[model samples]
Target: MSKTTIIDKEAARQIREGMKADCTKCFSLCCTALNIVASSDFSINKPAGTPCLNLQPNYSCQIHSQLRDKGFKGCTVFDCLGAGQVVSQVTFKGQSWRGNPEIGKKMFQVFPIMEQLHEMIAYVSEALSYEIPEDIADKLSIQLKKLQYLTELDADDLLALDLIMYRFSLNELLTIASNFVREKAISKLPGNRNIKDFDHARVDWIGKKLEGKDLRASDFRGAYLIASDMRNSDLREVNFIGADLRDVNLGGADLSTSMFLTQMQINSAKGNEMTRLPIYIQKPSHW
Candidate 1:
């Protein structure tokens, strides 16, 4: 692994906390800024810049509790990644689009940009929390600070920001962080699988029965694991970055040491009481 600045536990915790969504301070930006397509995930089609019909006067979703039950599963899965509060409070000084109709369009446009920046901060903060080498940790820490500074920018500054360059820089750092853990994982795998083409590394096991399988150190990044039966499987140290776990069966699955498994992903998945998880993540009330 490469050498980088090491961010201590306290600093990492602060970063993570800032990236959490505080909806009480937000103006229902997600419910307004983004468009929703009519599908299994959503009950109705909503155009961008318009509030959903269920949005209450106080910016609360009227059907929030029954989103999944009423065919708006996407709303349940959606997270603003702390963007909503930042834009509502910092950028606009607690102003709402309704109060200032002229800024409504611009606010909607900036919401998505802020969302991307905040998401990167979330990923970068998670990477920094790992026990990596000093040099790599240092680099991650530097990048984390940069993203944090970006989040504090004013609306005009944020709107003028070059997102493409920032993404390239952040992705490079994250890829390095990912590879550091992946290399360690691969080294621990048994010799039964082919070195050139490991089935665990590239298999499309979506909707497949992988119950009780030894999937240690496998790379499931960006793979479609939707509806896969993974009961009692050994997912120790597996890379779950970008993996889709929506409706995936995780009954009795061991994901206690899985990497990059976010709370959003876990909340969207179908897990039972027996499914083990990382100590830091809280189990969903519905599960």
Candidate 2:
């Protein structure tokens, strides 16, 4: 196959949804700096900090299409917060990387911090709008502004940023963020809270981690589980209604006669013909 592949419009659109201009500033740097090891989803010979042989000059992937076949599943999981462009557009003024080894090294060092700032931005932005009480809105807003400032920094400024930036009295803001996550999601998720009022009769676990845990016959209704890992766990007849299960992992789990486990969910998760049928699943193709 060729060194690179073209990203289709659908892929580009999906990337753009989570990608903000500020966030993408970091991704470009990450792409250039980080080395991804070859695995089941990416090729077998690569390392961090070394540019991927498949990367085009403009930071686009060469073998974008055959990623899985090339063993680059890790690439799909990465979310750069526009750190690339930040380094390129803000720090170096776009005059150095290709010809200057010293500048290239500095850009590589900046990737991690910008990525962290971008992640914090996502969380802070989400918290700002999640039902925070009016009084605490100002507190959250202040913290949000601080975090936004952290995103615009060059490598040196980011490295020098102190922990004091996160030292804010955000008790109410935290609660609002937590509750928003809980109410919109199932009571049980990666970050679970066993509140007395939680109605476990029906729950969803989209993109959660219950790996090697006991959750047999759990009622799940109106859940949005996208990429949860339930490896080698108990799941006999678990109800699943209105769940957004995109790429859930149910390897070595059981779901016999599970009510409401839809075909889409079944196809998305792991299952075999010998695996207890979920009515919706016609024997899986891989297993």
Candidate 3:
């Protein structure tokens, strides 16, 4: 447990804003650190720690505008949640791996760790935005402080962290907060006394046709929703933490109040202009 800092709504908003990726401040760490398998998503198979073929000397993607058209759809969906800039500027002190080849390996390793930490911070910050019980809010605040502190640590310390354990602990609080919010939403639904029916956490719905369904306040945590057709569905207040939304059709769906739905998830899915999204998430240009 870390020293708890009281995070008001405004502070939570600021924390989330700081977690957005700014490529100009980054050194194209994702292009080098992550492995790309040759699937429909990627044009080529690239090993970890190796730079992508499209990476330029200035760390900009050569095929940036044509990534999807150039058979590199995977690159389009990946979002580091501002971890690249934090690693490049703060962790490595504004050093580029290209300039200092010796730091490349370690910097690559640290990037993923920082990405996960930032994601956890984003989720906690989102939880704090809701009207949860004070006890849960206090615990979430402590966890947020701990995660923020971890991000500022040296590379070795970050590599030594047990992220699985941390994720498990943080997920407990997130689950509670999600349940609190969903329950309130469910209570307002017409004839919505069957609470157990909405507990669809971790269900396998891959490629299922769920068009125009009333799935409001449902818990889809860790669910595999790949290629599922959820067009025009009522997904308001649904908990989507860790749900695989790849290629899911959300055309005309209303997710304006969805919980824990990250930008990465939304980017991977197919949405139309009519699809209502949460205020924090931006609609993908491809949609």
Instruction: Name the lDDT value of residue 142 in candidate 2.
Output: 63
User: How far does residue 4 in candidate 2 sit from its true spot (Å)?
Assistant: 50
Put down candidate 1 lDDT per residue, 81-112, tens digits, no spaces.
77899999988888899867778888898899
Worst 10 residues of 2 by lDDT: 1-10
Instruction: Name the TM-score of candidate 2.
Output: 0.56
Alpha-carbon error at 127 in model 1, in Å? 1.3
Each prediction's RMSD to truth: 2.9, 12.8, 1.8
The candidate maximizing TM-score is 3
Candidate 3 Cα deviation (angstroms), residue 158: 0.9
C-alpha lDDT score of every prediction, in listed order:
0.80, 0.55, 0.92
Backbone clash pairs for candidate 3 read none
Residues 168-228, candidate 2: write the lDDT tens digits: 3443454454444444444445555443344344255656798776664354545666688
Better of 1 and 2 by TM-score: 1
Q: Which scores higher on TM-score, 2 or 3?
A: 3
Taking all chains together, each candidate's TM-score versus the true structure is 0.88, 0.56, 0.96
